[model samples]
Target: MRTFLDSFFILCLCFTTARSLECTRCTDYSGEGCSQTTSACPANTNTCVFTYSELRIANQVVPLTTKTCGNDNECNQISRMTLAEDTSFLRSSTCCNSDNCTSPTPILPVLDTTPNGFSCPACYLINSTSCQSTGTIACRGDETRCIRMSINGGATFSLAFQGCSSANICSMQQYFNGLNSQLNYGVACCDPSSQGSNTCTV
Candidate 1:
C-alpha cells in the first residue's frame, strides 16, 4: 500500500512537469530590443509571443514591444485601425513553442492609404470611457468595418477610440485581451452604415 501511494504521487509530479512551459518575458517602449528573462507560464498558456505596436497621433509616433507567454491561437496575428487622417494604430505578433525561444520582432503591416469608399463615426479620448465623435472619417484600404475599442489601463486611466478597422481586429479581441493582465478591453464592430447603439455590438 505504501509503495502504490508513492508511485501515484511521482506520476502526478511528472505529469505536471511535462505540462509546464517556460517563456521569455519583457517589455520595451523605445522600439529597441528588450532584456528578456525566463518565466514559467501559467497552466493555460502554451506559446512564447513577441508583439510590437505603433500608435500615431498627429505628428507623434509611439512604439511599444513586449515578449510574454500566450496561447497558440494568438500566433502571427495583426490588427490595424485608422481613426482619422493623422491618427492610426498598428500591432503585430509572432509566436514560438520552445522554452526561451528567441522570436524575431514583429513587423508592422504596410499602411494602405487608398480609399475603400466607406465612412464611419470617429472619436478618440484618454481617461474616458465614452467619447463623442468629432466628425465622420473616411475609411481606407481594408477598413470596411467600424470599431469601438475601449481600454482600461488602470483605476485612473482609460482610453476610448472609435474608427474604421480591418475585420481581423474584431476577430482577435480575445487574443488582445490575453496579452496583458494589467489592462482590460471592450471591442465592438459594426457596418459603417449601421444604426442605433447596438450597431457596434459584435
Candidate 2:
C-alpha cells in the first residue's frame, strides 16, 4: 500500500509539471529595458547623486567663508551662486528680521490715512490686483511698511527695508528698490524695473 501511494504521487507530480508553461519576454514594448520604461541608466552601472547649496546671512552680511566635507562633517558656510563664472557660490542677506539683528520694517506710521513721519512698523493692506510686481508707487513718509498682494490672491508680501529717515517719497522708493532686488532672484518673470520710483515704464 505504501509503494502504491508513492507511485501515484510521482505520477501526479509529473502531470502537473507537464501542464505548466514558461514565462516569455517581450522585445519592443518590454518593461525591463531602458527603451520602454527603465530609461536613462547611470554611468558605470551606478546611481547618480546630486548636491545643492544655499546662502546663509548673518550680521547683515555673508557668514560662511569656505566649505569642507569629511566622513562625518559637512560645510555650511556657503553663499548663493553668483553670476561670475569663477565664483561658484556667493553670500547674500537673509530675509529681514533674522537672528542677526537686522530689522525687516523700520518706519512706523501714526495713522493709516495720513503719512505723518517715516512709517516702518506700520502695516498697510493692499489689493491683489493693483499691487503688482511691475507697478510704480510713492511713499508718504519714512517709518511705514509696504505690502504687495499676489495676482491670484495667493499671498501677501511685506517690503524688505533697512531704515526710514524722513517722511518723503525717497524712503518709499528705496524700499521698493530693495524689494525688487530680492524678488528678482526668485521670480525671473517679474521685472523689477517696473516698480522703480525714479524710472518710468512705457
Task: Provide the lowest-lDDT 10-residue window in model 1.
Answer: 7-16
- lDDT per model, in order? 0.70, 0.20
lDDT by residue for model 2 (76-157), tens: 2111211111211222111111112221211112322233332222111222223223332332322222322111212423
Candidate 1 clash pair list: none
Stretches of candidate 2 exceeding 4 Å from the true structure = 1-124, 127-166, 169-171, 179-202
Tens digit of per-residue lDDT, candidate 1, span 62-98: 7777777777876797777898889887778898889
Instruction: Identify the runs in model 1 with alpha carbons over 4 angstroms from their true place.
Output: 1-19, 153-155, 179-182, 192-202
Against the true structure, candidate 2 reaches a TM-score of: 0.14
How many clashes in each candidate?
0, 15
